[model samples]
Target: MVRDLDHALKHVSLRAPAPRFERPRPPRGVFTSQQGFMRALGVGAVLLVAVLPFMDASRYTMSIATSALIYVMLCMGLNVVVGYAGLLDLGYIAFFAVGAYISGIFTTVLGWPMWAALIATIVACVTAGIIIGAPTLRLRSDYLAIVTLGFGEIIRITANNLKITGGPSGIHGIPTWSFGPWSFDDGFNLFGIDFPERVVFYYFVAAVVIVVGVIGAGRLAKGRLGRAWKAVRDDEDAAEAMGINTYIAKISAYIIGAVWAGMAGQLMATHLSAISPNSFQFLYSALILMAVVLGGMGSTPGVIIGALFVSLAPELLRDFAEWRYLIFGVLLVVVMLFRPSGLWPATAVLPWLRRTRPTPPAFTEATAVPASVMESVDGTPTTDAHEGDRA
Candidate 1:
């Protein structure tokens, strides 16, 4: 009996331990992952926009669509500052003004080509960004907002007074984009289909807004600088402690946003062939900011949706005439009351659309160790090997 017990003990000790239990991973399915779903959504949106002009082909329709696209570009740029960097910039339109004025002066006054004006616009916007951001970024919250608001007013007033900017009348006769002898005024032929000037311009704006405003900003948000921006936004002191230069991060975001707005301004200048002081008013800034907040800050899709809604809602509600503004305000209030975080916040998840995870197996007799194995030769309960090793 003693020999048999010894042999049993030896066999048990030498045997490999039962395989550790691991919760089974959820099965992968189409659109199961957030990244896959977002990618699909973005592609679908692009396809929809690309087909819209084909469906209507009307000047009125194209104009509205183009305007909406411009709004998207502007909002995306602002999204970088307000959404990603957590900065409340009330003067973002200043950059837009800078781009418009520069492009106008270059193309109209200096008699430079549209391409050259574009290059100058970019440089001016970058310089303006540094000037505004370097000094003001150190301030936080309400103070920063106030300072930015003042800056916006100052830019508008200065534009209104400047002779080159055409004072209150603003710059007029701003020419369309041209490359060498080819201009947007001359439409193109693609795949045997003749595209009109308006249609071509619409396509051009769509490409720029989607590529630079949407994709570029989205890529930036996923990069190292973007991470630093987020860290600073969450806690400036904590980010600094972690070796991040909070000032550099904040200013970089400001500068990138300025460049984006400047590009949008140039596009707008070409689209309208004119720009006015009234166009860059505080009200417009408020509307843009409202779009960002309504769409959910830090969310790219949400910002785009918000911009479209703000830009197109009035037209859609035109049947109400003068009461449209009141109705718009009421609707905005209702949305805020219901969804304070914006229509589609960054953390939002659709429960119905989400893939369900299988429940982990419950503990049972089969999973429990045998009483004999739990005890030592002297009959005292054996402590866990892992616990002993940890001790």
Candidate 2:
């Protein structure tokens, strides 16, 4: 029996041979080799903007770009609350209103410096975040959304009725921003192109701030805190078991989001040189949220593109006037229906961008032995030869 089994095993091994080459595979993670492509795309975008003045940098176009940049900032802020933390905050524009009102007061009424007013704006937004986020964050999903919506309305109404906010007339004649010897009202000639002083400076300023915010949000999303927030987003129970404080994480997301929005409001106040309660209406909040969703929630590039479309599309369709909004609504609905994940989904990368692929599986070595050793030295077989025979 042992001799017969040994012959059968050798025959099977000879018939089915293992591969000649075998090696362990490489580990997986976000690749650094693709950084060059990312950098190239970024450079290309900047170059396009730098050349915009050459192609009719009219006041209208520049102003549109400036407003689009502000919307980008707002969309990024909302992305933090909705995309990263998975919180639906419908009242985010309230923080913008608060910042505008607070800074407007310091600059217009008290005659404080614009820089000082900016500081006040930051404080007001942070305070508002804690005040609103602290209590509402304890609730889940729809309830939280409803509370935030209410908070937004309350802020708008308060601004409309308040004495300091200038009632319905709102604040006007707010001073232009300046830093030391440099003023936003100053213009310079470059490459034979004469740009408007105020518009050009704020355009660059808003662009810089938007870039910084994008980079900051990207870093935060990949950090330890970001992972914790994802944990809370994915499963609260599992995150709690893993020792995360979900409540604190949610509130922190709100505060960070609010700070970005406040800075955006400061930009707006300086750009318009005046602000009204009408500027911070519920519709504005809804619009910003729409930008975030349409751009691809949690994606920086997607959000920026989304913001530009939302802000600029209607302006470009000004000829249609009344019909423009109807067209806009239809476009959004179409986008949502077909590309529910947004135009540029957060998980997607350009085709030209190639990250390193995962390594292949390794081969294992198996020994081929004579069936004579299959016996336990007492005439019984140590192998499952009988089972194979039964099969």
Candidate 3:
């Protein structure tokens, strides 16, 4: 019986496994990949911004544009915390307040140059970030958010009460950026096209800061630190097991975000030549967080769009007078309803840009079995019925 079984096994031939179905790849080209396309779009946007003042250098236009750029800076920073690290910060504006107030005090009270004041602002923001993040980052989700909210309120109240911060009235006459003898207030002529203080400030200072901030945030999101942030965001325990220090990742994100917000605050103070407790209210914090969510967290392009929409939508709808805010709220609700993941979610792909490929046919049981496998050692095909009868 053993010899007969061995003979039968020798007669049976095994077939190789079926080939795996591979999806067809799109043709390689400059715009074929998402990253390449985004790069091109970013270049175009920068160029457009460079020439925008030439089109309309009006005070109203520059003011609105500058404000939108400030929003962009703030949103980018918040994106690092909430979007990348998955830390919900409800009191982010506190860092902004810190930067503005510190700069204001250094320049106006201490009679320091804007450059010196800026250095102070950076240090103060970093310290504030550590103070707030060190204690609160241990808490996750809603608890973290609540603590941040309280911290924001504390900063506002402190500013309102402190005489150095000008009390409730806040600081005014904060000087524009300057380096020794040269100053932004002096303005400059380029290519025989003379520019005024407002134009020079908007073009050189605000635009440059915003561009640097955006690029810096984007770079950070693509580096090793960014990977750790994403890992911690996805699964803290898994990341910890993989040797990532979640605490350090969270704190780094918080600190970077604080510095970004602080720079924006300094810019704002110079733009308006003032800083008040009323400006850093809880409402502004909520608005900044909303912009991050609305634009799609963890997405650079989406965040920029969200910031612009949140900042410009009100002004665009101002023709409606008192009904503008109502319309704006309705629009936001409608957008969220339709695109819950965000208008441009991190995973989103345009239909037209998607790779086109025919669907492969599904596998079936009939195709799984080979004819040789059903044959007997005697060279006669054997069916289940025949085998059962013989048994």
Candidate 4:
């Protein structure tokens, strides 16, 4: 049988197969081509903000810039809950209010320094986030939004009824940040330029805080936690299948967002020297949410750009009067119509592309020619043989 099979195989002929194997490719760095461009844009923005106050910028200019920075920080915080974790929160302003209120209570009522008040504000925000998130994080879509909106209203209404919070009039006489003998309230002269008011110093301080917040948010968005948040955002069921605790991941995002918002609230309280229940309105929440969506969700640069536009567009178009908002609405519609997923979408890179070591496929299904295609006269099988003439 063996001889017959061998004889039959000898009659079959085919071209020799070529030797082949995959060559190892180096893993791509974390910074993709487009990401590099965004880095450049961020650096330029930082430099511009840093030098603006020194370039004969008017008081109004610094004031507007300061407000824009606050929005940027708020939008970035929202980016975590809405953008990264994919949670729908309509009452995010509640956290902002909580932070400001906590700081205000600590400073004006409790006689705590601004720095210490800031610490208390952060703790309170984080705690509030957990309390709210524990109950509502499981909800999805409109349900989540409605629940959060209710929670926000509950907070504001409660504040309005409380004497400690100073009722509807809110807290006042909030002091600027100070340490030891130094206070941000004091004016200073730098080089040939003299800052006559606290606005310039406040502008510098806000710039620094905003820059740090942006950097921190960006880092969080790039870390392991960030990936988990994105995973939950994409598909909670699938993410759970992959062993990710969607609930925990979601709450984590909420807490981070709350902390960021709280810090921003503290800044707002000090910057304006007061906090009112009216400031934490539903409209502000809507606007912050809009800024994140208008800019690219999950995109740091897009959020910043969106924030600047939202905060400054009103001032820039003031000449248009009431028509300005109509025009702005039209422009927003146009932008959304053109780029729906935002200006910069969060695209996932392949494992091999993002990791230091590329993972190989486990097993490949065989779909080619069968291993044994013919049987010899002696009842022995022969490997693939091309049809041909035989003696």
The lDDT of each candidate is 0.88, 0.80, 0.87, 0.82
User: Using lDDT as the measure, which candidate wins?
Assistant: 1
lDDT of 4 at 317: 94
**Tens digits of lDDT, candidate 1, 1-391:** 5665575476564434454565465544445656667788888999999998789999899999999999999999999999999999999899999998999999999899988988998999999999999999999999999999999999999999988789999888988888889998899999998898899999999999999999999899999999998898899899999999999999999999999999999999999999999999889899999999999999999999899999999988999999999999998999889989998887777564566675776442222433355463446676665556569
| Whole-model alpha-carbon lDDT for candidate 1 | 0.88
Clash totals in order = 0, 0, 0, 0
Worst ten in a row by lDDT for model 2: 25-34
- lDDT (Cα, tens digit) per residue for candidate 2, span 1-391: 6666666656443334455457553323223334555566667777776666667677777777777777887888888888888899999999888877787889889988788888888888889999999999999889999999999999999999989999998999877776777666777667896667755755665565547577888899999888878788888889989999999899999999998889888878877888998898889989988998998987877887888889998998889979999998998999999989998887876563445465566655543343444542345655544445557
Clashing pairs in 3: none
Model 4, residue 180: C-alpha shift (Å): 1.3
TM-score quality measure for candidate 4: 0.79
Show where candidate 4 strays beyond 4 Å.
Answer: 1-32, 196-211, 348-391
TM-score: which is higher, 2 or 3? Answer: 3
Higher-ranked by TM-score: 2 or 4: 2
Number of clashes found in candidate 2? 0
Q: What is the TM-score of each candidate against the true structure?
A: 0.85, 0.81, 0.84, 0.79
Give the Å shift of residue 235 in candidate 2: 1.7
